[model samples]
Target: MQTPFKLSLSAQDIACERGGRTLFRNLDFAVEPGQALLVSGPNGAGKTSLLRQLAGLLPLAGGRLVTDGADADTPIAELSHYVGHLNAAKTAFTVRENLAFWADFLAEGQGDPADHLAGALAAFGLGELGRLPAGLLSAGQKRKLALSRLFAAPRPLWLLDEPSVSLDVASVKKLDGAMRDHLKAGGIAVVSTHVPLETKFTHTLDLGLERAA
Candidate 1:
């Protein structure tokens, strides 16, 4: 997949807060095109809050979030794909339906959404389970289904929070491959996870250390 335009994500002296408490302050990071940023921290260090801020789901407590090389009028959220802690699949819908819905809503490229459905499923080794109901899938399978959205629609920025949560070893490898392919295509990824991923990271931020200092 190719990005519609060149882009890079950067933050200067960013901070996060929840419940009137500051999590981290004076944090800085940059992710250029074709690079990944790995966020690590102990519990309550605000990894999820940081990702949410990047995704535009939460307001930044301080500092600026900047994207270079994109249109000034374009919102960062429109250029990003955020897969948070929860798998946003609708249980009653079939796996295919869930993916198809996301493909239609988040469509960016040419052709029909249906045309990308099968390929998305195949990308995550969920080819045969498309017909199954989403609720019937195991934890790992659901995670893959949620991840298939990356292939279903092409986006330059990916904000993934604990994406490896329920994935098995092989599934995690698949996830790594998908991320690698995205990076190879000049996409950027910001991921938060406790487990080590096979994906090669260009930069890493340890929120725990940031808070300690």
Candidate 2:
């Protein structure tokens, strides 16, 4: 897959606050095109919060988040794809229908999502399950379905929070391979995981340490 888009992510002394408590502060990191940044921390260390901030779903309590190589007017949310803990599939929808919805929404104007639908299902071994209702899929299958969107549409930045939650070892490997392919294509990934992944990560940010400081 040829990735014609180019973008880099950087955070400068960022901070996050929830309710009345500070989750993390003075956090900083940079990930260039084709690089992956691994975020690991103890529970409640704000790993998800940090990822949310990068995804533009949560506001930073302090500091700057920058994306280089994209149009200055482009919103970071538009240039990035965010997958959190929830498997956002609509249970009432069929496997392909669920994926197609996301592909169309995320890849809006990029291309006919149908062009990539079959390939996305095959990437995660969901080809045979495409016609089944998502509610009938196993937990792991649901996760795979959620992840299929990463391939259904190509985005410059990927913000994944605990993406391997329900994945079996083989599925994890598939995810790693997909991530590597994305990196090789000049895309960036910020992954927050407690389970060590097989993918190559160029940088790591430990919010646990920041909270301890």
In order of appearance, the predictions have TM-scores of 0.95, 0.97
For each candidate, what is the lDDT? 0.88, 0.88
Q: Write the per-residue lDDT of candidate 1 for residues 39-106, one digit (tens) a residue.
A: 99999999999989998999999999999988888788988989987889999999989988888888
Task: Kindly report which residue pairs in candidate 2 clash with one another.
Answer: none
Worst 10 residues of 1 by lDDT: 1-10
**Clashes per candidate (backbone, < 3 Å):** 0, 0
- Top model number, TM-score: 2
- How much is the lDDT of residue 121 in candidate 1? 78
How does residue 34 of candidate 1 score in lDDT? 92
Instruction: Name the regions of candidate 2 deviating beyond 4 angstroms.
Output: none
For residues 22-116, what per-residue lDDT tens digits would candidate 2 score against the true structure?
99988888889999999998999999988889888999899999889998998898888889988889999999998888777888777778877
Query: Which pairs clash in model 1?
Result: none
For model 1 the local lDDT of residue 82 reads 94
